[model samples]
Target: MSEPETRVASPPPAASVKVLSGVWRGLGPIVYALVAGGVLLLLMGRDPIGFYATTIESGLLSQTGLEQSIIRMAPLLLMSAGLIVAFQAGLWNIGGDGQFLIAAAVVAGLGAPLVGVLPYSLALALLCVIGFVAGAAWTIVPSVLKAWYGVNEIITTLMVGFIGIRLANLLIKGPFLSDRSLVPQTDVIPFKYLLPYLPGTRIHLGIVVALAVLAAVHYMQTRTSYGLSLRMLGASPKAAAHAGLDVKRDIVTAFGLSGGLIGLAAAVEVLGVWGYVRADWNPAFGLTLFALVFLARLNVKLVIPLVGFFAVLSIGGHEAARRAGLPNDFLLLLIGLILFFMVFTEWARTKGWTAGMRLRAAGRTSQREAALDE
Candidate 1:
């Protein structure tokens, strides 16, 4: 009998190595930003080590600190989810702040009166629905304009957001104004309408709702045919149309979904945390949410952890600034530096400078080999 052929199995591809390399490359800019921030702190005569220690202790080590950090992440996660949908569809929904305010105003204006008149569950559900509808309505005009008329959504959405803010302020200062207070805010919702908190913690049910929405969004984006179409549309609208996708409808739907999510966040914030909406109490969290979404590279899965990190950064920064005797805006400077570095790194990757250098070196090597052969 012939000897059995022996074959050695090839080693598995080094996927783990590639993943680590990618992660390291992604974190390079952040590392650089931290170094630069530390240098700046030293120049300003601040103790970088002490600042970081205090930040960690206050933001993560304490029970109250941890609870507040999680509580703050809820709204940011909701807003980031909305942004991801719009961004994936190649739409920039810059009016998130406006959408948030309008939704909150709708919930406050209608929720107080309806809480007692209707069953508690039904009333709460209706309020959430109204908030969603209101948010979508605010974006419909801009969506239509962008889809059919090829108008610039950035300008239209931004301008409309200012209008929405003004409208919300008017509502609060007028019809929704509470009779019991001088502030420009709606009357508080009945106790039954407020969301219950976890035992011994300020963290409420809003985080649970936000997590549910995140899971649904992740499922849709990863497993559904609609998500594939959206990715194709974002990559190239003409190509998607050639592939028989309804590009306009997808774009419009993206805007609607984005606005609806922001509205839901507004409803959660009012019902779970504040139980009221005040004209002067704009959180202006839209920009921060935008930053967090971009920082996560638009991955829905990454948004959750990134938002939590952002909350920690925010809370810790405050503590650090207080301890260091720095202005409240000092942390903003660090954040800005990090963003600048991220942008620069992205530009470098797009330019492919390192790849070009490698190609040139390879060409030189081939020429040298040809010379030797001659």
Candidate 2:
């Protein structure tokens, strides 16, 4: 009787398996890209290990280096967050640099006069709102063309960005030029308006705001019906329309929201770091941000880490080139290699090569188990 006691078997841990599967899927492509980059460096007669070591030491090992890297990531994070929205809606908003400049110019032109007239908090709030609105306004024409007339948003947005840069130059060199300095920059906002930095570091409130935006966007994309509609539209406009979604409205809304975030980023850059806008001093971060969005597969959760990774590379690349006599363009080569590998991996997955292999293996295992049973 004691030997006949029965015990319940626990079910297989499907949830843990699923979690591991997700982690592997997310990281596998990145690992492949790194290996490809290393091979490229070897082919070029460079020491890949030494390059990586220097990059790590210069970008992440030192406190000052880490602070600088995080500082550089602020604007990239903001632009990527905006890009995620537009890309998810199947829209290409390539004018983020222009939007960023226009927003900064607008805030600079407006904030100077309001600083002394309004309360500090009130003026800061107004400047932020105006920056956001100006950003959205800048994209209105492109969004309309895309939504109503089905124009190529890529071209329109890109052209509009050039116009924005010229306009910013006009504002800074003409109207907003500071009285004290001969430089082509606007008057600095009052010290009271400048955002305070984090204690013991050059990092400021903008980084915190960027993190908040990232979290909020992730929540919106994952938890809301609108996010589902945007994804549907991106996947297939005709199908989304068949589902009775307002495809046109969603397109415009997505572009506006994207531009708005870029504009807020501009405002934060000026208020938090520079406190003024300089003519022809654009970071030209649009292209870099665009690359990062794709590298992260348009996932907000992934954008944060990718942006930080890029910032480190950028800072370390410059340092390494200076100290080791390496070509600065080597960093660009690495980025291009990673992009190529990522694209290839995605193509393979789409063709079902990986899944087919897994299925075949499973079939072989099943057949062997049946033979043993027989």
Candidate 3:
């Protein structure tokens, strides 16, 4: 038979099913949450179907409202993308709120002065770069401590947020306050300096910048060796070290880059929207962005859709509170409940009967022993 020599390679299994199935698994929790929200609305003496439909139509279906959604979505996307990197590197930067504030402070301090002196576009470019650098510097303190002294970053990052907030206040009220203004705000940047709007909407070029950042980060995460090293270091620092990776550099880079992006969000807010620094302009963007970051399940790409969804909720909740005679606090309570339920639902999925992964391992063990006994 002359050895009948020929070897055949089996065709690869289709990965589409796994990809679709994974997406469905992740979305199950969201579906359950919507169901729960409907039940709660019904219990609250409201028609769940009518109210919910109105909420969506009013907040996202209308042109004006949709524009508002995109306007707010820009910062959420930018900040959440950065947070995603920090999370992927096993670094918890809970101070994005503060980092964002300080970045705005930098832009306001620098951008306002350059308004008439430099070209508007040039000033904007400088503002973004300086804000990024400022954010990186702000984050370095914690990164150094985490990498060298084993300090807990959750605490350090959060505490720094207060400091950052204070710094913003000092600049807005003390240093930069305009003599002609009675309010706690700096002199407004010339109107020519604000970012141009997207056609038919209030959304600006900053949204484009934000989307670009998301795409860049997604590419790095999925395609680059640097990103792979980062993910590996995050998954298991000890293993990354065993593979001779630069653990310290990756950690610093991850945290610093995250801070820088978040800072840019603040700069976008100042230069693109507000036109000036105001002490009371943001009660707490850092906190809101952190919530979006968590809701995204720490996936950089998923964070974009999640931010949009949440922004819709913000607009709807604001309108419903004003028009429906519902308390704003009640809407907040509803949002909190939704977030809580989603988190619980996700936890439950991973801890189902016999726990999926644990059961698979046990089944494999049983089969191996049975074959051995045979």
Candidate 4:
């Protein structure tokens, strides 16, 4: 009798293709967000149509919603992408809220002076670099403490979140205060300073910058030695150390990079939307943005659409809430559901793969046993 040929089951080509589709990965979260909508409609005792109409009119139907989406996208994408860099290196940067507040203040002040003094393109580039530097500097303190002192990074970094918020208020109310003493924010930036918007939509050049950054980060993660080291450490810190990786430098750098991008997030908002640094400009945006980072399963590339999805949810959810007579709590319920999915997806990513392989092996073993029995 011939020895049976050994075979190994592989992931289907379709699985890879499906995963490559942006909509496919996001579809699950979208469905959950929708389901939350249904719950709100039920509770509110109102028609979902009226709610959607109002929301659409507010967020998408008019120029205003579109602009708001762009504004929201700016911060969400930056926060998520920055966090992506940190998370990839097995470092948790919960301080994005802090970093963004500080960077935003600096960028708002810097953006004003740079307007038209340099060519538009050049000024934009400068803004990006400035935002990156400010954000990175914002995070350095916590990074140093965590790296050198063996402090619990999550708590130390999160505590710093308050400082950033306080500083923003100080600038708006005190230092960066609008000269005329009109609004609680700073002066409106000249239209020339604003990043050009898409012809038909409120989306702007920041999206382009974000896309470029996302591509660069993705390539670095998949191709570079540093990226490989980060991945290895993510898998096992001890193994990374044994393999001679510089864990300390990587950790600090990761936080800095993460913080820098987050800083840029604030810059985009100030330049594009508020045009001036208002202490109240972001209003808890960092909190939900951190949520979006998690919703993206810590994948940098995935952050882009996940950010959009959340924007849509906020718009749609608010609409859904009013029509359904549901309260703001309904929105929270939806957010929690989306987060739960984010977590489950992570678990599924790991366990799903493991479970699948195990099943495949079991099936192969059973087939061999049947042949022997026969």
Number of the predicted model whose lDDT against the real structure is largest:
2
RMSD in order of candidates: 6.0, 4.7, 6.3, 5.3
Write candidate 2's Cα lDDT for 151-185 as tens digits: 99999999999999999899888888888777788
**TM-score, each model?**
0.86, 0.84, 0.84, 0.79
Candidate 1 off by > 4 Å: 1-13, 190-192, 350-374
Winner on lDDT (2 vs 3): 2
In model 1, how large is the Cα lDDT of residue 357? 37
RMSD, candidate 2, Å? 4.7
For candidate 1, write residues 284-353 as lDDT tens digits: 8787677667767889977887788778878777888898998767666666676777787778767865
Off by over 4 Å in 3: 1-21, 329-335, 353-374
Which candidate achieves the best TM-score against the true structure?
A: 1
Lowest-sum lDDT 10-residue window in model 4: 7-16
Total clashes for model 3:
1
Q: Is candidate 1 or candidate 4 better by TM-score?
A: 1
Model 4 lDDT per residue over 308-340, tens place: 767766765565566556675555666677777
Clashes of 1: 0
lDDT of each: 0.80, 0.81, 0.76, 0.71
* Model with the higher TM-score, candidate 2 or 4: 2
